[model samples]
Target: MTIPQEAIEAGAQTLFEESQELDQDNSWDDELPEEWREAWRYAAQSALTAALPALERQIREQVAQEVEELKLNPKDSTTPHCVEEYNAGLTNAAKIARGKDQA
Candidate 1:
């Protein structure tokens, strides 16, 4: 089938106008080929999927190791230090309140 020149010109003009609009909008991603975008997305997703389990396992192992170390040396744990500080503060506050009541 023979295509008319007017139809070809119209199609070309439409493409040119769309390209100009895309350029004005300044979206560089729109210029990338669809296949390239799809492949990049797939690779990124695959990498994340592959790495997530190892990342999670590493985090869990580190936490468990820290917990075990804390158990082995409870004197170095922040929890005991915080509890002692809180208790001391409470005792001081009680003494201050009692002194005010007496006054």
Candidate 2:
């Protein structure tokens, strides 16, 4: 079967960029078509799939920093649960408005 070179290259790139090494004896060297292999290599180095988890972790850390800053604000009067309460209230209102409430 013919495979696009883009797929193999992408895969290889992703794997290498992630600092991952191939198992010379067991990796997808001779199994997949040449184009597919190239695309895969490309994916290894350039695809976002490999970096998604790392990026997500970074985002979470940033959000945590913002939360910490909010907690440190001396003039803030709201408790940490304040946002949770507001969200719950809004959810209840939406449910009632949609005629899902028993009462």
- TM-score of each candidate? 0.35, 0.29
Error of 1 at 17 (Å): 31
Q: Report the C-alpha lDDT of model 1 over 66-91, residue by residue, as the tens digit.
A: 43343323376668877566555554
User: Measured by TM-score, how close is model 1 to the native structure?
Assistant: 0.35
lDDT of 2 by residue, 1-103 (tens): 2334565565575564444353343354345567755566555555555565676567656654544444333235367477655545555554454335623
Which regions of candidate 1 deviate over 4 angstroms? 1-30, 72-103
Show the colliding residue pairs in model 1. Answer: none
Residue runs of model 2 more than 4 Å from their true location after superposition = 1-46, 73-103
